[model samples]
Target: MTLHDDAVRVLKDWTAPDAPDGAQEQLRLDYLDHLVSHRDGLWRSCLPAHLTASAVVVDPVQGRVLLTLHPKVGRWLQMGGHCEPEDGTLAAAALREATEESGIPGLRLLGDGGGGPIPVRLDRHRVRCTGRGRPENVHLDVQYVALAPAGAEASISEESLDLRWFGYGALPELTDRSVRELVALARRTTG
Candidate 1:
């Protein structure tokens, strides 16, 4: 099956208690339906809505999370981005992004043992279309929790201005609510 097909199946089977309400769940279902209905829905350039994967990386021993300073958005956020065609699954995409952006290897998805990559959160947020000259679009983000190996060191990539670990209670002021929510969910899931 194609990556898009896998995404459809994964989202269909996945459930989250932090989905906020019925509307959020409906939005996820709608995203799945959109993926099924459109041939190019999985691609990043798929106009208004497309699938994105991200991770809230944490060092359980340190009680801290690794966040990147996104240059484009000017916010400290989790490591994630658009799904690449080479990604075999949404979980793989999330892991790939986390590893690539955080410069930390051996990070494991928290709930990804044998059942597949279970999302820790589902967030749909609007992103301004500045680079491509397109209008504002929605990123249907599938979020996962990745545990960083103890004593792991992180380096910033070209995509981010800075990368650092922040204590859960001392997150940066620029961090967004969605990111905070993802971190909380990750802590709960791991605990």
Candidate 2:
């Protein structure tokens, strides 16, 4: 199946985690609708909003997560970005971003224990995809958790100004609420 087709399938098949406000359910439906309505929804060029893939790399043994200081956003965030044409599936894209950004070999996305590589969370947020003075766009992020091999050491990439590991509870103050929530959800999912 094509990348678009894979995206549609994953969104349709995804079961959003419970939220008090039913926000996740609504967002899941909205993403599914976006894919159905906008054939170009998964690509970065898609206007207004587009799907992005991200993964939080967890070191189960060390109990820490690797985060990148995004150059443009200038905040502590997980490794992820636009899905590329070469990505065959949503899971593949997330894994690729984690591997490329973290520079940690043998990183593997955590699965549902039964179903393969299910996303742990979804975040919709406004971003300045373009440089300064350009109008912002929204990103529909499909988030997952990846496990770094024991003793894994991370190196910086061009995509990030800095890369470091933060304890599950010690996430830097620079991180926003979305990263906090995603890390919590990822931890619970891993447990």
Candidate 3:
């Protein structure tokens, strides 16, 4: 399926309520428990499980946060992607994504430069082909926080249809609840 098409599918899953039979709901709960139970050990092991990460870039002086409009997820998101084997560190991956997506060269490490094994909630979303024609099943992602140097020049990439900085009190019209929550979390930390 095309990235656009897969996105539509995931959105439907996210928004639509599944009035599944009681047994089915129980099954889902059981699966989720199993997934969580194994996730930590899995993360430490060499396995192609649903593992990924992202960075929350904040401009503290401006009291605003940086967000990217990802083509696949089709929503504004933290700068992040899959954790590749060769990545020296998770924080480095987040830094790489933040710079590549924003063209903001002077982002500074904040909080713990290294982040996670923090549990994150994943939502269904899609993205354009990073290069391949077929769309991929995107993972639910965990992200870390990095502070952007005040007055750093930043421009949005094609991966993002738009990019903007939003203050704690004022946020753009957005559909992703996780993005909003992250913004609020960053605001609390910064303030």
Candidate 4:
């Protein structure tokens, strides 16, 4: 199946967590609708908005989470970016991004108790990664949680100015509320 098909399947099967008024449920439906209308919704060129996959790299054993100091956004955030042609599934995309950006090998995604990559959370945020001449973009992010190998050492990549682990309680002040919420959900999932 195509990556778009897989994304539709994953979202269909996922049960959004903590939907007090079905808010998360609404977002899920919106994403499904977006994909239905735009076959290219999964790629970078589909903007003014497109789907993105990301993961919170957590080393629960060490009580820490890895974040990148993004060069474009200039804030510490999770590892993720546009979907690629080689990405077979949304989960694979998230894992690939986490592995690539974290510079940590043997990294595995945290499942939703059913051994599935059902995202821990879904976040939509404005970003300037669309480039200089284009309009601003919205990343309808499918966020997952990835468990890093023991004693994982991070090396900075070109996408980030620095890579570092922060205590669960000590996330930098430079992050947005979405990141902070992602971390909190990840902590509850892993710890």
Off by over 4 Å in 3: 1-49, 112-138
Instruction: Kindly provide the TM-score of model 1 when superposed on the true structure, using C-alpha atoms.
Output: 0.93
Q: Write the per-residue lDDT of candidate 2 for residues 91-162, one digit (tens) a residue.
A: 999999999999998999988788789888899999989658989999999999999998999999999999
The count of backbone overlaps in candidate 3 is 3
TM-score of structure candidate 2: 0.97
Scored by lDDT, model 3 comes in at 0.57
Instruction: Write down the worst ten-residue block by lDDT for model 1.
Output: 15-24
Task: Report every candidate's CA lDDT.
Answer: 0.86, 0.91, 0.57, 0.91
Query: Which pairs in model 4 have colliding backbones?
Result: none
Residue-level lDDT of model 1, residues 1-109, one tens digit each, is 8888888888888774644457657767888888877778867788888888999889988889999999989999999999898999988999999999999999998
**Candidate 2 backbone collisions, by pair:** none
**Per-candidate clashes, comma-separated:** 0, 0, 3, 0
Ten-residue region with minimum lDDT total, candidate 2: 182-191
RMSD of each: 1.6, 0.9, 10.2, 1.1
List, residue by residue over 1-191, the lDDT tens digit for candidate 4. Answer: 99999999989988888666887888899999999999999999897889999999999998999999998889999999889999999999999999999889998898866767768889888887768776788898999999999888988888899999999999999999999999999999897
TM-score of 4: 0.96
Query: How far out, in Å, is residue 189 in model 1?
Result: 1.1
